[model samples]
Target: MDMAQRETWTSRVGFIFAAVGSAVGLGNIWSFPFQTASNGGAAFLVVYLLAVFLIGFPTMLIEFVIGRRSKQNAVSAFSELGYGNWTFAGVIGVFASFITLSFYSVVGGWVLNYIVGSVTGGYLGDASTFFGSVSSGTVAVAAHAVFMAITIAIVAGGVADGIERATKFMIPAILVLLAGLAVWGSTLSGASAGYAYYLSPDFGVIATNFTSIVPSAMGQAFFTLSLGFGVMVAYASYLGRDDSLPGDSAIIVVLNTIVALLAGFAVFPILAATDALTGSTGAGTAFVALAGAFGQLPAGRIIGFVFFVVLLFAALSSSISLLEAPASYVVDSYDTERWKVAVGVGVVAFLLGIVPAYGYVGLFNDFVFNILLPIAVLFIALFAGWIYGGEAVDELGRGTSLGRGAMTAWLWWVRVVVPIVVAYTLWLGVTNFYAGLVNGAYF
Candidate 1:
C-alpha cells in the first residue's frame, strides 16, 4: 500500500479523541494516584504539571511533526527523514510498545477479573487474597486472551473505522463516567480528608525529596502522555495537514491531566471513607486497596461495578493504541494487509503477554516503564532538537498558525531544553536499574 493510500482521521474530533485515548490509559487510572500518594501528594502534582508542559509538550510536538511529515510508521518515519541510525529510535519505540502491551495486558486482565467479580458479588472478600488469586496461573492467561482479542478487533478495523470510531465513543464515555464517579466520591463522608490528601501541597516534603519526587513526576508525565513509544507518531501519521500540532498536543495533555486528576478525586475519597487508603501504590493500590474500599461502601456492589467498568474502558482505550503502533509498522513496512498484520501482531503480543501474566509483571514493567520508555523519549528529543532542527520548525509551522518567532522558540525548546532534561531523567532510570541489580546480587 502506498503512503497516499493510507487512511486519514475522519475529522479533527476523531483525531483528538484517538490521540487522547492513546494518552489516557491505565497510567492515568492505576499509576497516577499511587504516584501522587507516594511522592508528596499535591507537591508531586505541581512538579508533574511542570514536567507535562515543559517536557511533555515539546517532545510530543516532535513526534507529531515526524509522523505527519513522513506519513509513515515510527521506524520508517525516522528512516525517511534521512536518519538511518536514528531509525533505531523508531525501533526502540516499537519494541517498547510490545514490551508494554505484554505486561499491560496482564494488568488489563486483572481489571477484567475485578469487573466480573464486582458484577457477580465475587469480590466480597479479602482484597489482597482476591488479587493474588486472579493475578497469576490459568485464570490470568484466560482473561488476558479475552482482553487482547478485543484490542485486536479494534486494530484490525484500520485507522478510520477502527481506532477513531472506538475512541470517539470510549473517550467521551470515560469522561462522563469519571465525572459521575468524582461527584459521587465527593459526597462520601471522608471526602474532605481525601481532597486534603490529594490537593494539599507540602513544600517541606518537596524540598526534602527533590531528587526523588522530580524523577517520579517526570516519568509519570511521560507515561500518562504515552510518549517515547511511537504511539503519537503512529496516530499522527493519519493526521491531516491542516491540524495544529501544538494546539492538538495541548488539548490532549489537558484532557489526559483532567482524567488523571479526576481519578484521584474519585478514588481517594472512597479510600478515605472506608479507611482503606493503606498507603499502597501500583497494582496493589488499584486492585487491593480500592477493591477493599469498594467492598466496604454502603452500596458497595453497585459502586464496585461502575468503578471497574471505568477501568475497563480506560484500559481498552489505551491498549488499542499500544497494539496499533506495531501493527501500523508491520502494515507500512511490509506492504501487507492491515487485518492480517493486526492479527499477527496480536498473536505475538498475546504469547509474550503470558510471561508477564503469570507473574513477571514487575520485571516487564521495570524494563518498559523505567528503561525503554525514557530512553526512547531521550532519543526523540535528540533527533528533534539536533538532527531534525530547522526542518522540524518548518514542519511544526506548516498548516498551523505558528509565526516565525513562536516556531523558533518551540524549536529551541525541543532541540535544547527538552533533550537536556530527558537525558538527565534517562540517566536516572539507568542508574536506578543498575543499583537495583547490584543490590539484588544479579550483577
Candidate 2:
C-alpha cells in the first residue's frame, strides 16, 4: 500500500494495453453489437461516437486529473483532491466498482462455464439447452463464484505482478482469438445480412426515437469506456509521469472502438446464419446465439472453446480492474493490509454472485446496470466537473499541445453537459427499476 513512490507504468505499451483491456470487455463484444442492432443500427453507432467524443473524453480527463492529482486510490484520491465534502464522490466511486464486479462475476462465471463445455464438446449436441441452463439457476452461481475467485487472486498480487502482468498476455490472446472468429464468421452465408444490420444506418428509424436513443448513446458512451468510475482515476493516480494523456486516451479509444467493430464481425454473422436474431436482444443474446452457432457448425466444439476462452480473458481483465478500484481504495485509505482488502472483496463478491444465479437474475442485472452504476458515475462527473474544476483538464494537457487546447473546452463540456446527462440517466434507471419490478416490464 506504500504507493508513495508514485507507480510508474512498466511501459507505455503496458499502460495502453491495460486501459484497452479494461475498455474492451463484454460491454464491447457482448452488449454493444446487439444493443446497437436493437436500438437503431448505425444510428446507435453515430450517437455512440458523439458520446465518446463529447462526453467520454472529458470524463476520462476528469478521472485522470483526480487520480494524478491525489496520486492515491479512489478513497484517498477523492478526499485528497479537494474539500472534505467532495470526498463523498470518492466513496461513491469505490462503491460503484464494488457493485459493478458483483454481478459481473456472474457473467464471468457463465463465460467460464462455456469455456469448460467447449473443451468437453458439449456444444456438439444441443446448443440451445446447453446455453440455457448455463444462463440461469444454481449452476450459474457456482460459475460466478469461481470467476470471482480468479479475479481476486489477480488483484491480490498488486499492480506490477498482478494486473499488469496478466493483461500483457490476455490482451494479445483475446485479440488473436477475436480476429480468428471474425475471419471465420465472415465466411458464413448470412454474414452479409448481419453486416447490413450492423453498419447500415436507418435514419428514418432513428428519427422516430431520437429522445430515447440520445440517452442510450450517452450511457453506453461512458459505461463502455469505463470512464468516470474513479477506476481510471485510480489507475492514473498510480502514474509517476504525465506522458501524453491525449495520445494515450485516443489510442485507448481507437483500440476499444475497433474491438467493438470486430465484435460485430464475430457475433452478427453467426446469429444471422443460425437464425437466432430474435426478441429484444437482451444481455442473454451473445450467450444464446453464439452458443447455438458453435453447436451447429463443424469443429463447433473447438470454436466454442476458443470463444469462451476469449470471453474468460475479457471478463478476467475487466473484473481485475473492477476489484482494483475498491481494493486500492482500502489499501490507500487505512493503510490496511492489501491482501486483506483483496480477500475481503473476493469473499463478498463470491456471495453477491448468488443474486444473479437464481430467480433474482434479471433483478440483479437491472439493479446494477440501472441503479448503482449511473449514480456512481454521476457523482464522478460532478466531482470532476465542479469540485476538481480546471485541475482535471490541466492533468490531461500537461505536456502536450493537443492537451492544452482541448483541455479547456473538454472541461467546459464535462462541467456543463456530462453531469446533466448522468443525472438524467440516474432518473431513468430508477424508473426502469420500478417498471421492471412492479409493472413486470421486460428488461
Candidate 3:
C-alpha cells in the first residue's frame, strides 16, 4: 500500500483519544505520584507543570507535525521529512520502543495478575511474597503472553477500529473510575493529610532539593507525556493534516495530567487512611503498599477490584502504543501486512520481556527509562530543532491558529530549551546509573 493511501483517524476526537491513550499509562498512575512525592510534593508538581507546558507541549507538537506532514511511521516519517541519516533517529526510537515494551508488558502482566487476584483474594496475604511470586517463572511468562496478545489484537485491528475505538471507551472509563475512587477516598478519615502532603509546598525543601528534583520533574514530564520513543509520532502519523496540532496537544496534555493527579489523590488518601507506607514509591508502592491499603479500606475487595481494573486498562492503553511504534514502522518501512507486523514484533517483544520478568527488572528499567529513552528524546529534539528547523515550524503552524509569536516561542523552546534540559537529565541518569553500578547498588 502506498503511504498516501494509509488509514487515518476517523475523527479529531478519535485521534485525541488515541494520543491520550498513549500518554495516560502506568507512568501517569503508578509513577507520577511517587515522583512528585519524592521530589517535594507540591513543589515538584509546579516544576513538572512548567516542564510539561514549556518543554513537553512544544516537543509533542513537533512530533505531531512530523508524523501528519509525512503521513508515515516514525522511521519513515524522518526519512520523508529530512535528509539521509535522520532516519537513524527513528531507528533509535523504534528500538527504544521495543525495549520499553519488553519490560512494560511484564508490568502489564502483573496488573493482570493483580486484577484476577483482587477478585479471588489471592493477594490478600503478604504483598512482597505475592509480588515475588507473580514477577517471575511460568506465571510471569503466561501473564505476559496474555497481555501482549491483547496489545497485538488491538494493533491488528488497524487504526479506527482498534486504537481509536478502544481508547474512546477506555479513557473515559478510567476517568469515571478514578473520579469515583477519588470521591470515595476523600471521605476517609486521613484524607486531609494525604491532600496536604500532595499539595503543600515546602519552599525550604524545594530550594535545598532544587538540583536533584529538577531532573525528576523533567523526566516525569517527558515520560508522562510518552515522548522520546516515537509513540506519539506513530499515533500522529494516522492524523489528517487538517487537525490542529497545538489544540490536540493541549487536550492530550490536560487529560494525561488530570489522570496522574487523580491517581495520586485516589491512592494517597487510601494509603493515608490505611497507614500504608506513605514513603514508598515505584512497583512496590503500586503493588504492595496499595494492595495493603485495599485490604484495610472499607469495601476493600470492591475497591481493589476497581483499582486493578483501572490499572490494567491504563497499562493496556500505553502498551498498545509501545507495540504500535515498532509495528507501524515495520509496516511502513517494510511494506508488510499490519497483522504480521504486529504478531512478529509482539512475539519478539514478549520473548525479550521474559528476561526482565524473571529478574534483572531493575537493570532493564534503569537502562530503558533512565538512559535509552532520554537519548532518544534528545535526538528527537535536535532533529526537529536543528535539522528540520523552519520546515518543522511551518508544519506546526499549518492548518492551525498558532500566530507568529506563538510559533516563534514554540520553536525556541523545542530548539533550545528542550534539548538543554533533556541533555542535563540524560547526563544525570547516566551518572547515577554508573554510580549505582560501582557501588553494587543497582539491580
Whole-model Cα lDDT per candidate?
0.86, 0.75, 0.84
lDDT of 2 by residue, 173-222 (tens): 88888999999999988888888877778888778976567656666666
Q: Could you arrange the candidates by TM-score from highest to lowest?
A: 1, 3, 2
Candidate 1 per-residue lDDT over residues 186-214, each given as its tens digit: 89998899899889898898899877777
How high is the lDDT of residue 331 in model 2? Answer: 78
Flag regions of model 2 displaced more than 4 Å.
1-7, 441-443
Error of 1 at 50 (Å): 1.2
TM-scores for the candidates: 0.97, 0.93, 0.96
- Ranking of all predicted structures according to lDDT, beginning with the best and ending with the worst: 1, 3, 2
Predicted structure with the largest lDDT when compared to the true one: 1
Instruction: For residues 1-443, write the lDDT of model 3, one tens digit per residue.
Output: 58666888899999899889889998888778777766777888888888888788888887887888888878888667656588888788888888989988988998999988898887877777888889888899999999999999999998899898999999999999999999999999999988998888787887898766776777777777888788899888887777788889999999898998899899778877877525735545578777777777678878899999998889988998999999888888778889899999999999999898887566776677668777888888898888888888888887788798888777777889888988988888887778768987645
Worst lDDT 10-window in candidate 3: 276-285
